[model samples]
Target: MSSVSVNIASKVQLVLRVALILVIFGWILDIPGYFGKYYYTEQLLALVAGLAATITLTDPRWGRTPARATISLVLGLTVFIAFGYVSVRYPSLQLELASAPPGAVALGLLMVLGILEAARRQTGIFLPLLLLALVLFSMFIGPKLPDGFQTRELSFSRLSVYLALDTNALFSKILDIAAITVAPFIVFGFLLNAFGGSAVFSDLAAKLVGKYTGGPAKVSVVGSAAFGMVSGSAVANVVAVGSVSIPMMARAGYARHVAAAIEAVASTGGQLVPPIMGASAFLMAELLEMPYRDVALAAILPSLLFYAALMLAVDFEARRLKIGGTSDRLELPAQNSDAPDKHRWRYLIPVGILIYLLFFANRTAGSAGLWSAISIIAVHLIGPPAQIWHRLQDVWKGLLQSAAAISDIIILASAAGLIIGVLNLTGIAFQITLQMLAISGGDVGIMLLLTAGLSILLGLGMPTVGVYVLLATLAAPALIELGIQPIAAHMYVLYFGMVSMITPPIAIASFAAATVAAVSPWRTSFASLKVGAGVYLVPVAFVTQPELLLDGTLLETATALTRTLMGIGLLTLAAIGHMSRPIPLPVRIIAGLLAVANVLPVSALPQLGMAAVAACSLAILAWAAVPARTTPSLKHENT
Candidate 1:
């Protein structure tokens, strides 16, 4: 594989590198686009970028496998031509779309096959093949499908053309979002990586937290979470900080799986951490047409609460297993070594400008991201590096990474379009929700539980934007039908969907960590479940009590935040079986129950009713931890 990578670096990667650069360069607007149409060129370039980068990233000897390269190249061409050919000629495209001409149908079917193949290569065959099966099922057996799943006989000819040309299907606005909006953030992340941001965060974490009990593990959590919020991709986050933190934890006497799980859970949690909780948040802001700041602020408390629970879990487990702190002999990397510390101060400029643009300047996220990218290049070129030539190369590299990142997301966007098509075609979204409500007997608990479960499962297999789009279009409507607030409903789905990266079956973050640590993927994912327990609960709390989401009066919101943080503490203690000392099983149960109770939506009086249980549980745990005279003397003598 390493030899293959070497081969790829020298050969087949050039075409993709050029495509990404061209696509990113086109964003600047000065370049005359392809054959008089820049839009076609851009879209084509974006498509080419995905294929080229995927090939380059995976196959070291990118061109060595002629079969893989040929297939990828062919698929790339199909997607570019299919979408570009139609979108540019949107009218004739619509005609083809409306009537489903055989030529167009043949084209669309071929395009779908290409996308499936491309997706299979990027993330493996599961998602692409599964989604393809669903598409096929919709086409063949749909009319004859059983109840709850039946649809009219899909006209293969018409459907193909419709799906191909209609913006609502394969080449939809979601794809546009991927191109215009999501691409820039990906660029920002690439630039951050090209510089020293990931390493900076990790070292900063270790400098800050690497000396306490279980310090390396804690640093892994803190650093990964901090970087995850910035990177937005679980796989990237794990690969970035886990490269440093995972090994650190293993060296600190933590088992490989446990260490990997810590990094994976924390890194995955970063997707939910605010002010920019994943790229999906940007999409949410656009979907709701809300200010990005408001969305970031809305995500603030929930992110903190989730991290609080994780931190507490790490702490308790550290105590339970007597995991020691970082050894003083551990070495620290120089903050700015080969990179030179001269521009160290200038590093703050781009980040500062980005923050200002988002919070005070009131720019659209797309505009803010564009300016931020510009600032990064500008500052590095003028202020610090002085090596204009080297920084230029950095810019080119960042552009390629940015473009390569687009492929997975574009497929997700296209898949989302198909998902939307399915829902609109069958009106199944509402029906499914109605059925869920009916199954739950209209009880909020059952309703929320089911909705959240679906969100997580969907989230596990999908990207942030895809997951939210799927759930928002499906489960959210039912919650709204039950009178949930719109923002609350969206946030509920968003949170669960984001956490899915760490959830089992398709836990991207865990798998990513396993790759870095050389651990069993399943063990890493399952262990992540322990640290990420609050991910399962936080979404429920926010939905049930919007106050926890800061939707009400300051006093109420403050109170809710406090209670929720406390609940996180209690839950963490219970889950890790440690509170000052090992908690007895019954007491652990009691604390957990109280924690769960505290999170439930309750009227004012009902809230107070649960206080007794919490207060009593705390008292009993404290009492139990009080060492008896005889036992205390024997324990001291033994020590």
Candidate 2:
């Protein structure tokens, strides 16, 4: 492309991004309602999808070569035309029933292909490849499969039209959640960070734990958790928090890979934290048809246990490696150099208002996010006059970044809708459920394990929202059918889906952190797995004993919480191979086994047996905390 064309494309891209943000914010704030010209959900979704696709294709980053640029521009234009046609004709198309017009059908095919390509450009090839495989199977191979797996075959045109135009396919509830509920929060997080909220979180975390052993790693955990409250992406969290924390940890005596792993695990757990979790949590509330607050409330104990386990593992590892606390006190970075004490309130007040709006005032998540974003702006405006222009520039950058981030999510959600549509159209969802049941042989444990594995597998190289959508569609049903509670089954998949961020063979988040730490990605990934081991088992505990999700009476909930925390602490000890002193391999094995036994469902054994198991686990833990007789222990190790 020539310089003139490049300038034109850049201008167009800017316009598209601004328009995308305005459209989403308009819908969120009901500006259309005020104007007496409300857009139907499908029409609005089509518009958003069109804008996202066009933006993705015209992005300079994706157009590295002339040929690729030409191809992307052509596809971008084609998608714009198709989505515009659908947006204008959606109402009439809805009335067409089984027969779509030839133009709609042709455009639908174009739209589907364009979306898949856009997704490939934005994310990676795995998701698009999987969606393509499913499309081909639905179109050709469905009826040829074995009796248990077969479904009525769909034609190419019919399938394409349905996926592109149907309410449940490309423009589904998942897309709605992404555009309306998630986009605002993404913007809120970006704005919060841009206005020094990240600095506030880091400074607060450092103050709280920087003098202790493994202080930098602990800061990563606390800061990431605070940042995760508003962030929806683990990789984003890693980049934002780990950029500061990783180097801090390395300076504080942690190995580069260990520092990266700590940041990766800490960042990934942010999605599991409450107030505001990942995009999937919003989708979960919608899927389960419960209030978002209820979902957050239920997530409390499990998220806490996850962080507790991570903190314990960090402490144990610090002791084992003989890493000590920083001698000098930590200070806020340069961007937040002005009156660092006051910077803390910039984040605290907005977050407090967000919590109040969500939990106390009964506001929708999107509304809470909008108000929180406004509060962030208000806080920044109140800062020193000389810095206002710089901060506003940061806010503008955040707006564009949020739009870009949201576009990626929009693509993923649309692709997910395509998958869900294929399943529903081919009647394969029921077949898969039956196949899972048959494979499990009516065993709930086996079914849970199968689901967990599949969740992790599908999650590789995918975002949490995309991972959860796949599992929720393909696996959660089977677990629910196996008599698991609806919330438990959904939360189970959500938890396992998150583990992939730290799991090897992909571990996208870990790899991102490794880049910052200048370490081997593989080493960082495996170390992250060790630090975040609790994530793998906590889901099981919640699934088996719902009290961990706060679904039981007070006593039952307390008992489950206490037992699971103990189990997590013991599991961390085993994984780290240290306590007061280095534990022998046999003792580590025993601790691991006892951790599992402690977290087993109360109903799995009689009351007396459960009590005995808990007692034994506690006794063993107490014994492990004592200093070894043969080896001299550092005083810090005994803390």
What's the TM-score of each model vs. the native? 0.88, 0.95
- Report RMSD for candidate 1: 3.9
Global local distance difference test of model 1: 0.69
Query: lDDT for every model?
Result: 0.69, 0.83
Q: Model 1 over residues 522-563: C-alpha lDDT tens digits?
A: 998898888766556777778767887678999988867766
How many pairs in model 1 have backbone atoms within 3 A of each other, for residues 3 or more apart or on separate chains, i.e. clashes?
6
- What's model 2's TM-score? 0.95
Q: Which residue pairs of candidate 2 clash?
A: none
**Can you tell me which runs of candidate 1 are displaced by over 4 Å?**
1-17, 20-64, 140-142, 145-150, 324-337, 341-343, 382-386, 604-607, 617-639
Those runs of model 2 whose alpha carbons end farther than 4 Å from true positions after fitting are 327-343, 384-388, 631-639
